[model samples]
Target: MKVSFLIDNALREAVVNSCIGILLKAMDIECKLDNYNFFYSPSGFDFFDRTRENIDLTLFPSYNVNRTPEQLSRAIRTNSMMVATHAEQIINSALYKEKLNTSAKSKYSKQITSHFVWGPFFAELLMTHSSIPADKIYITGNPKLQVSTRLNTSTPNLSPSKSVLIVSDFSLGDMDDERWSQFKKRYKANYNTPIHRHYYEARRKLVNWVLTASERYPNIHFKMRIHPGEDRAAYELLKGTNNISLVGDRDFIEDVLDSGLVFSYSSTSLFEVLVMDKQVFNLDLHDLPEERKGEYFELFEWVNKSQFMDILRNYDEGKVFYPSSGRKKLLEKYMYGGNQKAVLRNAIAIKDVLENRIAQYGFSDFLVHYRNLCLSLVKDKAVKAGIWFNKELGLQNYISTLANRRKEADLNNPVRLNPNKIESAYKIASGIVTESEIEILKNNLYEIRKEKDGIYIDF
Candidate 1:
């Protein structure tokens, strides 16, 4: 059997996809990895679909449930099955609840939970929301965990090393600062507890704290790894006096696994570290206000002075703590309260559904459908916006090839100001009216008629 993994980014696809490839290879199945094609080939998304038709199966991994299951199901088409691994709680949280609407909510809640899904706690979700038969859903252990074990076993003589992993948040509106500020104001007024504000304040304190620690412990190295989606400037500003090394885009996960201790305030990467059996110190400095404390703590691990200092001292001694035997224990006791061992255990039980089972639709079929829909929408939006701007600015006439000829005539003869060319360029450049942004060029002709104004622009 042969399989192909289709993903957008290299660093983003490293963990789970790598693990699945290794596992399938060990089973004597040919695993081919497709990467960097998106960068070199503009039509790579199209080429990927053609290639998918020849594969035995293709895995489309996703963490969030932003699109409907039907949308997901129809996107990929081929002779092979499409598999996805989803983490339920992360999607069900209040953060995602706001991003989805009533129809999207019903679709995701209904069909997504039914298919070949893998995550630590999925049983409860499946029991409550899914309508698909139980046998179809497989709980292949998180490939991240399976792959991490190899690192420990491969090198029995590995020595202790000090490393700190930094992760960025999915802060509300890091894309546009103006919109982010507005969100901050509304959140402050209504909820009285802004999540991003707290996260920023904590990050500020932690960066300084890390700098102090790095200075004091010269032997220990510090590594800052920013999230892919985070605003780079915000991260830089947060690093007050910290002159530590930064992790490049591709080195994030490898660094995390190799670290002696992981220090993070609110990143989900901390959970990944915990799964690696490494010591994780969640630096919860200030207490949340009474009313918001309960919900806020769910997103972060509460770290007091005693626990923080103890973990720091322990790291200096070359000792590491796993905290719990498995994720079930760690999550059940300290994180979300439950006997979630069944959920964890079930996740590892089914791994062969993709091998012999028939797919409702193939990978190529889904990819072509999704790719066409997306490209069409993107092109339509771009053209419509360009037309609207062109018309509103009154620059329509300047867009014609004739306008360039008029400019050349004036360029050759410095003594003569060509009214036609001047007017055409002006109309094209000015943002005036939708009917003929071309009209502004006419205004330029008026400027040129005053021949004494000798400043000229070449076409």
Candidate 2:
């Protein structure tokens, strides 16, 4: 039997699907897993042309099967059982609503035979929110959590460093279409400001706080890890600080393990830090009212700039501020369920599906596996060669030097402001602010236009 796991994102989803592919193979099931970017294309029909007849099942990660008409028709023609497993633990209320609403409206939910979730909390959430049948929801804990637990156990001696790690979210950057729409609707009602401007405003405050803390305590290091979708150029202002550094592409687990304290606005990494027994602080500096503070603040130890600064001072003096004792209970309730052998359980469930003992699903080609293996080997070797070349020529440092030079040149150039240019730039920068605010910003910029070489506007 052949099974294909379709993936989009590589960082976390690819890792989880690869582990599931191994588990399926151990259970004598032929599984082909790889990143498929077809979902991002306009014509979703392209995915059907890439597969063969013997493939019996196709699994997706937290995606509705009938997103497009072509997708629904392809599923019907292939007669393949489709399943979806969430890639991350759901924490954001907007995301939860989006997923459940999409799942409820999906016409191919029956063909998408099962929905594997992280824990009982997610299962209950789905059942309570969506129209998907209760039996189809499976509590197969997240594979990433299982891997993280194992890595943490084996690397227990990895001591923490005296550095503060900032786990950034994609909110500070250009958001996708769906997320943009949700943000507009959600924040417009609460704060009466544009969603992107709100994110930018909050991020500016947090960055300033970090800079102030770095200046106050030159002995401690501060590292800002940019999110995958974030444009590093957006944070060019923070460059060249004495005690601050921007993290480059590196393994997140290793970075987290070595961090003394973790800070985030609202990232899923907060859960991972809790599991690792590390100090975590949420930078909750939004201007929303109390009722609109969101659900994450209820669970995490979110603090304002003053509180965070105090905590930093204490940490610099070799004192740590541990989270309240109820954090572990909250962790168990929301993220993990104390199951370390989730991969084994997932494997057994897939085995039952293949054998027709559980919900009927349906793979059988030896050459397909051989061809995939050969391609993967070639890709792996090519990656290794590129790494070796970069190290031998010190290409990374050279690239960094070039980037810094360009940034310096841009910083030295004074930005001339006009009414039309200001309006255009503000629209591009603060996607979705009111007309009144735009006028206010223009007037403010006019006042400060001649005072400095480069104008810096902070809302």
Candidate 3:
């Protein structure tokens, strides 16, 4: 049987798919993995070329859910299966609530053949709220967590540089006028809150706070890692300062592992740092209304400038900054479950679906498929025209060049895993994949290699 996994985003999806691919190949299963630019790809790419390939199953990360599932269902043969994995372990509280409410009224479960989740928390969340059947919701854990844990243990021990790392998320300042206007419209419609404005105000306040804190502690070097796809020029002010530095084109996990202290305004990295037992502080500088505050923030220690300064001073004096017992418990319960065999479990679940061990859900009704077909036809034409126009104007080449540059930046910040630990994890998970195959898979997963048609996974 042949299985294909789609690579939507390089940094996030590649590692999980690589592990799955190796495991499948080791089990005498054929697997194909490739990258696709979600925005530029034709709407019916999944359907148009389905007949050319003999794929029995396709595994996709969460981003593919934006479009109707008919795109896959109508394209593939009736017997083929489609599986989805949650992109992140923790679903944002607001989005979670929205899903729960909508699931109560709609049968959105028909959207996919099978759904793989992080743990009991997510599985339970879906079972109780979503229309997806409990049996179909397999708790495979998160394969990415396994990689993160392995990387954390394998990382080299370096002398403490007494550096504090600040991680940034997207803000209004990061967007151009046109993009900001579109974002404002979408944010207002979906959230019913002024997220764009609030984010701008909060980010500005937070940046000011960091500058002030940096001035107070001149000895401790402060580094800000701007979020990917953000405009680095927005942070040009930090360039002139000696103590403050903007560290771009670096892996976030590597930064988290290396830093003496990590700070963010409720980023997912907080959970990652906590899992590694690192000192992480949350800067609650985003001045959102009480109702708009996400529940995820409660997991971190919120500190203002004065409290942050105190923590830095204590850390500089060789004092250990311990989180509250409550925060530690929260981290243990939600994020880190001490399981490093997620990849193996994920592979086994895929195998089960492929072998008919797990019951599969059916596709959407004919009316829905017809609607999708009509919408896809229009979209496909628009995309073709856009591509033709871009090529005529040399915009296609320029865009491709920019993408290659970004891919190169990602390749430089490679994740080095402990070879011995990787074998151990594979053995523990009963993975039959050979060590050499796993190594080759890891090397090619994060880098983009060009093909005659487009960029493809070398592995």
Candidate ranking (TM-score, best to worst): 3, 2, 1
lDDT of the candidates, in the order given: 0.45, 0.57, 0.60
Each model's TM-score? 0.59, 0.67, 0.73
Which portions of model 2 show Cα errors greater than 4 Å?
39-49, 65-79, 88-97, 102-108, 156-160, 170-193, 289-296, 320-324, 357-459
lDDT order, best first, reads 3, 2, 1
RMSD of 3: 9.5
The sequence of per-residue lDDT tens digits that candidate 1 reaches over residues 1-459 is 667665434444444454444434434666654431221111222223444445555555442234333234333433455544443233333333322222244433432322433332443344344433345455333444444444444434232556656555535325354565576443222334455556566666766676666666666667776665455665564344343665545434467665676776555555556655666666775444454333324535567656666666777777766655554354443222132222222222212444346555435435646765576445445444544555577554432223244335423432222344333323321321112212222232112110121111111
* Poorly placed runs, candidate 3 (over 4 Å): 36-52, 63-80, 96-107, 157-160, 172-190, 320-326, 357-459
Find the 10 residues in a row with the least total lDDT in model 1.
448-457
Predicted model with the maximum TM-score: 3
The whole-model C-alpha lDDT of candidate 1 against the native structure comes to 0.45
Q: Give the number of colliding residue pairs in candidate 3.
A: 0
TM-score of 2: 0.67
1-459 per-residue lDDT for model 2 (tens digits): 878766544444444455556556544678765444331111112344454364566666655432333333333345566666766545445444445544444443444577677666777666666656655665656656665665566564354557888988745346554666675554333333345556666777777888888899898888898876576776777899978888734546656766778898867777777766677888876764343345555666778888898888898999865556588567666543443545544554454455552323222122333444454445445444544555676555433344345445433322212233333322322321224433433343222111111111122
Cα RMSD to native, each candidate?
22.2, 19.7, 9.5
